[model samples]
Target: MSDKKNENGISRREFLTKGALGSFLVAMGGATVGGFALPKPTVSPGPSRRYKLGDPGKFPVGTAMKMDKENIFLFRDVEGFYAITAVCTHLGCIVVRVDDGFACPCHGSRFAPDGHVVEGPAPRGLLWLEVSRTPDGGVMVDADVEVDLGTKLVV
Candidate 1:
């Protein structure tokens, strides 16, 4: 009984084969659905990015300074430090800076000043980017997210 033509129209053997094949395809950058085709990945700026965190003076107290359209918050905490992110866990909707920390304009998800998920829809915190200052006074940051960040990331 490793294989059988089930009443669901998909053979048991075929189901296993497709399941394995689909997983492999998905791992290979091609999502293989049972009845649908895999869409091609568009040419994009490769997954490497390094953004400067600027200076602490750039962002004053209370007000959240906007970085990008998605990254629109940088609250100055008691440590004279700041947080940054553009990812929204709830349906991946980009969060915006509200009177508090950040808010997902799409579905009303909210976050604390420390990137903590203050409201539902978003179940996680923002990314705490490890940054540094270069000799030129401009900051040099390594933002490659797919790799481990607990260790020092060389720019």
Candidate 2:
């Protein structure tokens, strides 16, 4: 073949290169525009860390109620209400409530009734979550917020 220039004074190889570059630029521009056009989420996307357990009266004093779905145990004592995570500190396994306290079946980690580490393999004791009373006299627990041990919300 002959190395002849096209009508636009560009050779076949130059034309092909320019075409490829133009296509790439157009594709990138479209992607940018599409990204900008996408709607932004107003709220974060994920499972909520805060749970509202309605009616403080529902949880009577001197009772320990386990919320399996939220992986937390709610306790209401003579003083007030408190929450502790049921997840084992060692391996994130669900701990079963025993007569004495809690036990992890996954790796044999044990916790006391007050969530202090009783057995080995666990780095620390169970987490104590923040418990608060809502404006409507409802109980709310925030799993994401860890409070000091033995902290109770006196409602």
* Top-lDDT candidate index: 2
lDDT for model 1, please: 0.59
What would you estimate as the lDDT of candidate 2?
0.92
lDDT of each: 0.59, 0.92
Q: What are the per-residue Cα lDDT tens digits for candidate 2 across 22-56?
A: 99999999999889877766576899899999998
- Which digits, one per residue and each the tens of the lDDT, describe model 1 over residues 1-155? 75666788788789988999998878766433533453434565575566665554564555446566335334454444334665676777777767777778787788875677888777677666655566666444444442221332222
**lDDT (Cα, 0-100) at 24 in candidate 1:** 86
